[model samples]
Target chain A: MSKQHESVNIIEVKDVAFSFGAEKVLHDISFDIHRGDYLGIIGPNGSGKTTLLKIMLGLLRPESGTIKLFGKDLKNFREWSKIGYVPQKATNFDAHFPATVHEVVLMGRYGSRGLLHRITGHDHNLVRKSLEQVGMQEYQHRLIGDLSGGQQQRVFIARALAGQPEVIFLDEPTTGIDEKTQGEFYALLKKLNEDLNLTLVLVSHDIAMVTKEVMHIACIDRTLVCHMSPEEYLKESHSEKIFGHDVKVMTHHRHKK
Target chain B: MNFLSLFQYGFIVRGLEAGMIVAIIAPLIGIFLVLRRYSLIADTLAHVSLAGIAIGLLLGVNPALSALGTTVIASLGMERLRTSKRVYGESALALFLSGSLALAIVLLSLAKGFNTNLFNYLFGSIVTVTSADVRIIAGLGVVVIVLLVAFFKELVYVTFDEDAAKVSGIPTRLINTLLIVFAAVTVSLSIPIVGVLLIAALIVIPVVTALQLRKSFLATIVYAEFFSLFSVIAGIFASFYLNLSTGGTIVLIMLAIFGAVMASRKG
Candidate 1:
């Protein structure tokens, strides 16, 4: 890929509006996700943060406007393998689901491998590499339900990584984990972004943590209230405007330059 | 008669062939259905198959073929209603289950009365199974197995997480439809040996028994296959000598295994 292509906007959302029955959730939402961008979307509960992410992921369609993925319209885009998704933890999965960690991660290759194609040794290697990246390679043969919440989260990330996606969309990835695990999770995301040059789009409600971890903050409350660098986001009054209160911006020691 | 001597009877051989085939394919579809909490769909389809059998007997057609046709169409309708959210899953199943049973009763009455052939269908008579039934069961069993194998990973992926599978471009809608269709076929093929009323038990009990072991998905399916085969084969032999209802004996054996598994797990 050329440098110009590397810097191009990979996702373009314009004038998107959505409603659930009679209740309008999002309107006039527009944003651009550039290559290698680490963007965090934060909003109040039921503020359509996850809904917007779902729309972008093609799990749901926008009522109006358009979404362009990889410079192609979302409807016409067929390259789903280029995108990975980690849904909200603990909500969408059965705890007793009988799948080994290795098997779960191998599913990431299913889309690219297509139907009737056998799983190759290369797919196993990629699954292993993905698990190693998340530091869960040793637990590959264990059932997914047998792992802790933090470990399960890591496995899910590994499953996403196995797809070798350029961009990953995470919906509240750290909702139920402990604070320490949440910190480590954010660090992993940062490493993937900085080391692998993977674009990250995270939907979260932890304003402070998201603001500290993400390069760009998109504050949403039924609309795109603000999308700017975190430095500018903190300096501006967008938090108060969206949250209906003053959000005290905490200063954390920057461990990484 | 000795076990070897039982094979001397052509009907016995045919019944075992058909029963064993149904045993193999039942759990293959059963595991997915059980895991999805869609076990009742099998029962619903079986009930729907009863109405189809009545229609076939009245119209002078192959009841198995007609039942397959009805159940397949009904399965598609059930899938649509479940996905459309217009009807709750259980309620939709109830509607079809009761409505089809009522239709079967009316049709049977119109046909003058339930004959010995229909009685065998209602409760299963392995002794009455013919060579034609064996061929049909074997042929449809291969189809169910092939479809399950070809989409094994995709079905597992969908069963594990439907939303994630859809987002990953797995064509989950098509997969879901294929599963229900497979269920329809399994239920219809099972009716010859397992009977209409007890077919769901044959499809479900083995899978439920295997779940008690808490094995991996593939291992669970293997265990369910073992349980199903054991029940079908053992029940056939015992029913042959004891003059018991074949379907009832098979289900009772499965329940006994389930009970033992539960007891062992508790111990």
Candidate 2:
């Protein structure tokens, strides 16, 4: 691909407005997600952060807005294989669902493989490679329910990676895991962002962690409050303005290698 | 009588053939239904099929065909109601189950009260199964199997995580509709051997028993298939020589197996 095409915006949201019944949830939300952008969406509770991500993934439609994915209108865009999704691990699925880790990850290939097609050797290879990428290759044969919360999240991430998507959307991916596993998960995401250059959209409640890790922060509270780099967002007064309080922006220090 | 002697009777032979086919396909649909926690759907559709059978008897048509048509349409309506969230899933099922049973009773009374034909359908009588019935069951069973195989992965994915499957472009709505239609077909086809009252047990008990093994999804289906076939075959033979109700016998055998499995697992 040419440099111009590579640098084009992967997602474009314009004039998006949505409501649940009588109450407005999101209003006048407009933003562009460029290639290789690790954008973290953080907001107060019931602020439509997950809803915004769902709208972008076409899970929920904005009442009034236009969404263009890969320059194609959302309604007409059918190439879903180019994008992947890992929903909130703790709440989205049945923990005891009778799927092996290998089977769960293999589902990521189904969109690209199309309907009525058999799983080929290539598909299996991709599943294996995705498992390996998440460091869960040894547990591929284990039932997904047998794994811990952190391990299951990694399997879900591996499932998204199996699609070889240009972008992956994660909704509260580290909600139930321990602090150590959460750090490892963030490291894995950073490695994917920096090494593989994959566009990422993370919906999270941990503002501090997100601000420290993500390249861009989109603070959403009923609307697009600010879309800027973390440093710029922290320097500005936008955090307190959206949060409705004097938010203390703590910068956690890590020992450099 | 020897085991081979049963095949000498044409009705017994036809019953076994149709029963075995239903046994195989029931679990194929049953595994998905059981895992999705929609087991009551099978029973609800079975009741709907009874109303269809009543309509067929009144109109002098093939009861199985009319039953298939009615259940398929009712299943679609049930799906609509459930998806619309206008009615909770269990509530929707309750509405259809009782509504159709009432319809069946009124229609049966209109057709001149309880008769042998209706009784045969209520509790299965394998002796009444004809070559034509076997042919119909075989033909429609193939359709159910083919559709299940074609959409196997999509169905599993949707059953696992519906929202993720939708995001992956799997046409989750269509797949869900297709599954219920398959269930309708399975329920209708099963009536000749398993009866309206007991078809759900055929469709559900084996899957439940298999689930106790805690295997992978595909392996669970395989084990369910084994249990279903075992129950059907043994139930048919036991009913034949012992003068028992085929549907009742089949369900009892299934319950026995389920009891044994649970007991063994505990031990």
Candidate 3:
């Protein structure tokens, strides 16, 4: 809302480092995410990709360095409604969990209204619009657990979208879903980013899929290996250092396309 | 005796009042505990409430109020212990459960012996329900219900997924701790009808039964309340006629309901 915020980067990470006990997961990682950027963070299983995402979301604090959201210190950033996060896809939720898709999506409005405040008509419209965005408006009355994995993931994303955030962080959103469903999910993300002007940061293990979809790519291993346009990343062949040489074989096919 | 005549006794009236309140709140809190996979915390806090009652007996204080105070603190402590890296989750509860029982034993011994009054708490004597006990249960039950209603969305969101709740800036730690506290308060308030030994049943059985039905969350809540209230009221009636233990009878009724529901679902 401020003139200064309009000129500021969506996220700024500087020299951030994190460790788990004796094992150092991230070392001196730095990157800036601008408005309207669809950035994909790709790495191997133990490569600290999720940890880095958690740090950026302020869920886990890095051992060293500073991170800012909306040009304010991550610790001091109070306007959480501006950011939405969809956690890992293996929800482990109860099969009989009593909540409907509509109820789950309405949760996104909670941060704005907070405790004791009722969800207003605007919030309901946002929930409906979010479900519509995910092409899940018809399934609003369905139990979340009753839906297929892909449908459930869409509902989860709709829950995040109902917040009406400027930026959304998704952690391995397509895992466990089938390949064809993954394509549709990516197309949905693309629409959300381009049409809604929503900044998107996604963590995924599928290098070929990520490289083709995201406008920018941040390849992270123990640290950030490269932050560049997808075209440059596909050409430079630096992905091997992050995802290993197998990634070169994967991206090589993409580069020819 | 007819059903109308059962209301003549003041103690039975108080018993119904307290049982009704516990019936609604116990399973209400239990549903969340079950969802969070913290169902065992209810059992552990119930044991801790027994210790509170023992300490209250030794100190000549109101056992229900003392149990209420003690279990609230223990519940907060359990929340901290639940995250202890050194102890496994169930093992942590085991420690509290056994430790609280041990404390109750020591307090019971210190008081010289378990008097008839003290014995009433261990197995529940709704036939001897005091006006003071009813007042406390009513007041505490209302507070717990109010808190649950006010934060229903946040509680459900957190129970469904804690990490997502935290990143959404929902004050997840506070809600998590508050939920445990509510469980503690529910256990303490329930002792008059269910007793410490059977209080966990009051909290868990209704919700487990409701889970059998394919219902929405709000419908599940309403259904659980209905089942719990039926068990409490019917158990009291059965106990009065058969001269059986009130707490044991109530839990037995609920267990029978749970078994029937599970069987019907399987069939």
Candidate 4:
């Protein structure tokens, strides 16, 4: 990585916490993600990963602490053109809802265009290019509900890419796809990081594949455990720290694999 | 009567103009209303809006003014009922519908001499409509259509994927409030033609008919607008020939169109 890329922080989350009604989901958490860093967030279920992402994106306000994006306060980042998001597979949307793939991809531009403006020629060009990114070019005019699972996921990624976002946060983008496609999905995300220099935050439970795919890994169980490089994460001591008593079982399982 | 006869005939032209304007926007709003599973809300809110018009009559004001004002309030209440976490939106619609009507009845019976022409607000008197009503409905229709065009993509996005819209930084709450207020304005205009009990048919029938053929959002809006525009005109003329109530005939035609379209889609 370039010295500037390594030094410049893209996301600075400080002492963040959140709760639904009264039940607190996340305790005090703090972390910093550098520009072009592909960071993976891993945790067991109900570990508040999704909530933390929502808080970072300004969809949910933390009970305490602050979030800063690109050196400015998160709330001040009104430029949606800078960020892309792929929510979990379940939220891929109601397939029965009427929209062509091209129209669906065009929605990424809606945030930047606001209410008064219509899609222009430039917007259409970007949509076409984005569809090509995820190999959905031929399905541009097809209804979204007609696509298979992997194709739908690709369509969603293309929709996010249409915004030309500098940073992408995907909440479990590989779910439900077969093992082979899941590997391919990771390769695509990695390509995005290297080609477009996009900063990424991925939340997933699959530790085995994530360490190979991402540059940085964070252990989150309702708090920021630590963030480290893939090499650091592979160390036995770090594995002991992350998995604790389960580390023996994990190592034995890895042996079987 | 000559070519200028309708304009020369005054009330005939006024009623036609008013019916046309209502027919345009009600079904346009109905597209999202049906999509978001809010069809029942529109139907129930029409009844609640009627209750608001009754309260206006009981208070001895121009029923439209008070009706418009109270219906706006009632529309907000409907949105709140839908959003409140403890309340299931469907059941809340039923509760609000019945509750608002009961309140209207209490206020109406308490007022002196309400049982007479007061019922005209329930099952509109289209022939009794005046030129002023025509102007208001037309003006409101223009505003509604303008907003719809300007906010088409945003509105569609919000209706289709509310969580996505919110996460993407769209002002979804404001858009939702605008929809409810739009529905209230639509209901107020429609009551003059179809009455409260049946006005929802004006909104639902055309959109439902259009849904059978439309495979895209853009097409859905076009077909919905066309269906309503022509249906209103046909219903008005049909009533004139049959010597019947304009709103009832319009809705019957709309339902028949829906039934025919459904059968065709099946066949």
Docking class of 4: acceptable
Score chain B of each candidate by TM-score: 0.98, 0.98, 0.97, 0.92
Model 1 alpha-carbon miss at residue A205, Å: 0.8
lDDT of 4 by residue, B1-267 (tens): 444554565666777888888887887889888888788877777877767777777788766666677778888987887777578887788888888888877877777536636666666667768777777778877988898778778888788777666666678998899888888888877878887888788888898888887467777777878888888888877776677877788888888888888899898
Ranking by DockQ: 2, 1, 3, 4
lDDT of 2 at B252: 99
Q: In order, what are the TM-scores of chain A for the candidates? A: 0.92, 0.92, 0.91, 0.91
Tens digits of per-residue lDDT for model 2, A91-189: 677867778999999999888888899889999999999999989999999999999989999999999999899999999888778789999999999
Taking the tens digit of each residue's C-alpha lDDT, what string does model 4 give over A192-229? Answer: 88998889999876777788899888878788876787
User: Across residues B52-85, which tens digit of lDDT does each residue of candidate 1 receive?
Assistant: 9999988988898899999999999999999999
The stretch of ten residues in a row with the least summed lDDT in candidate 2 chain A is: A248-257
Q: Write the per-residue lDDT of candidate 1 for residues A1-257, one digit (tens) a residue.
A: 22335478999999999999999999999989899999999877777999999999999999999999999999999998999999886678888777789988998989878888899999999999999999999999999988988999999999999999999999888867778998999999999999999999999877878988988888888999888888777777554654564344312222110
- The worst-scoring run of ten residues by lDDT in candidate 4 chain A lies at A248-257
Model 2 docking grade: medium
**Compared to the true structure, candidate 3 yields what TM-score?**
0.95
Please provide, for model 3 over A83-160, each residue's C-alpha lDDT reduced to its tens digit, 9 standing for 90 to 100.
998988675456668888998899888887787887799999999999999999999988887999899999989989
- Candidates 2 and 4 compared: the better one by lDDT is 2
Task: State, as a TM-score between 0 and 1, how close model 4 is to the true structure.
Answer: 0.89
Q: What is the DockQ of each candidate?
A: 0.67, 0.68, 0.60, 0.43
Work out candidate 1's RMSD over C-alphas: 3.6
